[model samples]
Target: MDRTLLEGLFRHAVAQAQPALAIERHLPAPPKGRTVVIGAGKASAQMAQAFEKAWPGEISGLVVTRYGYRAECERIDIVEAAHPVPDAAGEVAAQRLLELVSGLSEDDLVVALISGGGSSLLPAPAQGLTLADEQAINRALLASGAPIGVMNLIRNQFSTIKGGRLAAAAAPARVATLVVSDVPGDDPALVASGPTLPLRGGRAEARRLAALYRLDLPEAAQRLLASEDNLPPEETDAVFANNSVATIASAALSLEAAAEMARGAGLEAAILSDSIEGEARDVAQVHAALAREIATRNRPFPKPVVLLSGGETTVTLRGTGRGGRNGEFLLSLAIALDGVDGVSALAGDTDGIDGSEDNAGAFVDGTTARRMREAGIDPQAALANNDAYGAFEAIGELFKTGPTGTNVNDFRAIVIR
Candidate 1:
């Protein structure tokens, strides 16, 4: 298998999902009156820049993005904040965004650029809850191995600006949200905890998820969830009447671009699914088995074929690993393959960061396991300790692409020959 070709396919997939390219056509026209843009996400700053370039009239607003993911924009003020966890900077940004669009008329328009990571980038705790309280719950949720959908549900319950509350705040104005979907199935309500989309379930579901995950919520958070004082408003409320959402970019588009690249390289490509979900290591094991079958018996597809898939995966974190889900997936795949010939794979987050790690993901070939063993590193032991990053770093197989300025979710490709 050509490792260079496999890496090229992954790069092409990420390029296809770039916010600058995907957000242009979906931009709404300038409103008749004032146009105020407010958003929160890793891609939001880039999305704001793209909107400014495509927009004709003068527009002004503020958006919060993960620290180090900011894009240069003249009109829109880009604020950097913590991601995967909320901090004081995010709380301030969320408050300022709410104030920016507080009392707009029907002639005004609110273009909210929401994408992945917004839930953490724009943290506005509910009336009774504090930022530290929200932070505690968020930290627990990240370690709980719950899917993005359920995590966002819990987030919305404790946020003042999430679950359509941002749009509701700008009640009389028309709210047009341009979303870069990072969740499975491209559910707008799940992206960035759906600041402009309505809540799915009420506080009861939030409580159920917390109990199911055994999250030890803070006193204030527990009180907020238990009481009806700060629950999200009904979805059918009049505030949502003029709110609309458009998914400009998603994982499916990136997967298709990858398939086209594979075909161009004289290899057959199959996109298994763009909405795959589950534990990272378990998913990698399944892909490894499929690759083995194709390389040996050819049941699924012939040799010289690339299998591609997208979607986010979770890690339960039972150990003190220093890697994200992508690295964990590649490490597990290497172990399952066990030096089988003619198989190579790459797994990464399109946003150029995996979990809390600095690398986008990692790469592995058939000899990955053998190389680790030769270096006196036990692959199984590493996997057991959730130290995929350490294993990959020792073998010099980490893939680092700093801040791709967009996010659809995880990207995985297995090349069998």
Candidate 2:
């Protein structure tokens, strides 16, 4: 029953961020000329479908989402591609997107449905850079423990359709961007590297960050980062004259919904934060401390309370791990909370994936570690090898949600009773 309740909190967070529920309310009016919709993200396909149903006039366009994340659409075309790592399919789609937005006039409208994962789903390598170059750098950044903002900034430098380049191509055509923000600050400019929004940093900033993180970029990627030509256009450029952006859904809003759900269930609830970011294991330790405090002394909150938080966390790969950030977080948390009674927790990526695994995340209580030990699994050893997924899988404690069709970031909840 505690597991069910904890999962309920996560579901509430995810449901609140659904594009179908939020997109129509934020959409711009239909244009007098052509209305072209172009989007990329885990939620873009659903956004297109919702927009299609809401529009009163003719509309046509394309959107790209992660493979197997495709949603059915009639007027707008939905394309599936690789995520976290761009692919040949994404490269072809990126080229096509630039062409679609070009040759348009002020009478036309470019509706950009942007969200997290869009940055990777549209992998248009900039001039002199190849898709392979982008992919290698993207992989490196993911494992470097760099924050999402820095990662996106670096990716923006290597893309032909990001950092306001997409909107620039639609010059003379008004752009209306609706976003599902997944970054720490909910900066629409950082969502999917701000493909339709002008994010003002350039090659210099990217190079500085790359050096700071010791990123190993391919020769072409390194050269591109060092070149003056790789900088994004100025924010005051005329290309952005008639553009507008709206954050339709975000981590803060999602966390609020989860908190409300807890309250509705007659539990006193508190939201710790909606924008925490750092190494996953480190963040888990902080969360465990909070949970321990509430459970042992009830100083922060009374018993029968649930604490909720939302944000993206990073994983610096040190071992041959087979799990994502949330998995790493849960394993560390379980170890810290071991044998502490009446405290249970759940952490999941709202998009229904916790790293590369099928599980959204996992569930844990004070008994989690002891249970693992009983099953002849050393929890600490598994975490050391970055094998949290394997540990949880061996015990059938994995939490799987196929695809929630939306993304607001990570949803974490701790229940103490």
TM-score of each: 0.98, 0.98
| Model 1 worst lDDT window (10 residues) | 22-31
TM-score of 1: 0.98
CA displacement after TM-score superposition, residue 274 of candidate 1 (Å): 0.7
Alpha carbon lDDT at 133, candidate 2: 90
Clashes of 1: 0
CA lDDT, every prediction? 0.90, 0.89
* Residue range 1-417, candidate 1, lDDT tens digits: 466987798889888878789777887867889999999898998999999898888799999999999899999999999988889999999999999999899999999999999999988988877888889989889888899999999989888899998888988999999999999999988999999889688888888988998888898888888887767778889988867889999999999999998999899999999998889999998999999999889977988899999998898888997999999899999999986998998999999998888899988989999999888889999998889989998988889999998999999999988
| Candidate 1 wrong stretches, greater than 4 Å | none
